[model samples]
Target: MTYLANPTRYSDMTYRRCGRSGLQLPALSLGLWHNFGGVDTFENYRAILHTAFDQGVTHLDLANNYGPPPGSAEENFGTILKKDFLPYRDELIISTKAGYTMWPGPYGDWGSKKYLVASLDQSLKRMGLEYVDIFYHHRPDPNTPLEETMAALDLIVRQGKALYVGISNYKAEETAQASAILKQLGTPCVIHQPKYSMFERWVEGGLLDTLEKEGIGCIPFSPLAQGLLTNKYLQGVPEDSRAAKPHGFLKTAMITPEKLEQIQQLNALAQERRQSLAQMALSWILKDPRVTSVLVGASRPAQLLDSLECLKNTNFSAEELEKIETILK
Candidate 1:
């Protein structure tokens, strides 16, 4: 059977402008970081993608080194794109990042004109994309001069390989500098992807203010705190949970007894708000005007649907905010 996207996909989901740019992303964007890798089931990720698009999640975030083998995620996405999403390409916002260790030797990693240019070329080939909606520098390269990196991104845009450019994992000062450089080169930094959630609040320190000042949109990854902020951990770690896995970003030791207690407390508050803990976690982030959208990863379609439910109730009361702060404390 052929896959046809739902005609009513945009009827309910929310879209926010990316900074001052004309691009508006769904409130919840799908990230192909973990589950869509070469190691995961194709049918599962395919269903996840279908469900995401059916609900107006037009933004698909990716990185060159996302897969366990590196580059496999893009290959898989390219296959899916060719099969299911080709006709709707104009409506989608596909993004990919570089700046991490991708291949080998000197030119394989970091932020250099040669590396970024080559990496995006490889990424374009893998994803079957003539140009990505957004291309990003995955992280700040201490050894690479900021001018070289920002110029490379500008060049990529001029070459028509990327419509917009952004930076990820960059601090306030770095972002300000990068934004300035890109602006001088006649391409504004449209967005900034950062590690942000209730548990991870480093962005609030200074990054958020800088992004706002620079008029760059903010899309936070790990908004669920690597699944810790969800209800699954409130009772105890599930046998199938990320904490139970021997390998992965979330370690078992990180889910301490104290952390479990906090999860329980947060879940209780979520219940009062008539939302799942995951919803509250996402809603907490979306409540801010500075956050254009949030990057959410789901292993299954149902999980993606549950995460999107956060859209229904993004408002937070003063008491609720204070209580959450106390619980986090």
Candidate 2:
């Protein structure tokens, strides 16, 4: 079926301006970090992508080293792009990153002018894209001169290979420095994608203030803390959950009994509010004006839809906020 043929699909998920940029992204963006990889089943990947788009999730996040085989996720996602999402390319915000270990040798990774630029070009080819909506420096490279990395980003934008540029996993001070460099280069940094959730409030250390002061939008990834904030672990680790998956990002040790107790209390609060833990986790992050979007990864279409519903109950009363903070404390 054509992506637009489903009339009910467009009724859900809201779009918000990415900071002050002209681009508007779905409130809940889908990420291909976990599933949609080499080991993941294709049927599951296709269903999640199709269902997400039909439900108005127009933004998809990808990185160079996402899959177990490094580039397999982009290759797999590209297949879906060519099949179902090709026709709606204009309506989508497709982003890919480079800066992590991809390939081998000196030029294989990091933030050198050589590495960042070349990785993006390879990413464009792998995803069969003429240009990506946004290209990100996957992480900060202290070894690489900030000037060199910023120059490469400026060149990519000037060449029309990417419409906008963003940074991920950068601290407040580092982001402020990069934002200053990009601002001077005429390619002002537009967004910052960070890992934020109730359990991961490390960004509050100053990152949000720095981005806001710099006019850079913030999109938080893992708003569910790799599914830790969800109900999946409230009882025990499910057999097929990320915590149980062999060599997954979420390790079994992370689901300690103490952590489970925290999740249980949080889930109780969520239940009282008539929302799921996943939704509450997402809503907690989105409560900040600095957060422009929540980058969520889903293994199933139902999970994607359920997360999107978080926006519907985004408002949290002062008491609720206080209670959450106390629990988190």
Candidate 3:
């Protein structure tokens, strides 16, 4: 069956400007980090993408090393784009990153110009895109000079491989340096992707302040803290959950008793707000105006719909905020 997008897809979602850039990203962007790989069903993956787009998710985030086997997510997304997203290309913002281990040998990873340039080329080929909307250096490389990495990003933009450039997993000092270099290169770093959630507040210490001063947008990954912030683990680990999976990042050992207790309290707070724990978690991130968007990953379309509900009630009163802080503390 041919897929048709909803006519009112843009009605409910809010778009925020990405830093000082002219680009405006959807408040909630869909990420293909988990279940869109080759091991997953094509029909299910395609359904999630279609459902997200139809509900006004214009930004789709991917990484060159997203798949278990590596590069499979981009390949699968490429096929789906050719099939369903081609007509709406201009209306969507597609992004992919590099700087992680992708292939054998020294040139395959890190922030060197050789690796970043090659990785993005491969990503574009996989996604069948002339140029990605945003291309990011996946992480900082201690060995590589910051100048070289920023120069590579600037060159990619000049070469038309990407419209905007960003950096991920970089600390405050590194971000400030990279942003300065990119600014000098005339391709100001437009966004920063970090891991931020109620359970993870590393960004609050300095990254958020640096981004605001540098004029870079902030899009937090792991906003659900690898499903720890959601209601899924409140009753203990389910056999089907990520924590139960042997090879996944969220291990069973990480789910401590104390963590579960905190989750229970937060879940109660979510219930009072008439929202799911996941929704409240996401809403808490969106409560900050500095947050350009929250990147969400899902194994199914229903999960994506639940996350979209975060948009409906983002407001939090003084008491709710204080209680949430107390629980998190």
Estimated TM-score for each candidate:
0.98, 0.96, 0.99
Ordered from best to worst TM-score, the candidate numbers read 3, 1, 2
* lDDT of candidate 3 over 21-49, digit per residue (tens): 89999999999999999899999999999
Q: Which ranges of candidate 2 are over 4 A from the true structure?
A: 1-10
The better candidate by lDDT, 1 or 2, is: 1
How many pairs of residues collide in each model?
0, 0, 0
Weakest lDDT window of 10 consecutive positions for candidate 3: 63-72
Per-residue accuracy of model 2 over 257-292 as CA lDDT, tens digit each: 888988999999999888999999988888888788
lDDT for predicted candidate 2 compared with the true structure:
0.87
lDDT of each: 0.95, 0.87, 0.95
User: What would the per-residue lDDT of candidate 1 be over residues 147-212, giving only the tens digit for each residue?
Assistant: 999999999999999999999999999999999999999999999999999999999999999999
Residue 67 of model 3, lDDT score: 82
Better of 1 and 3 by TM-score: 3
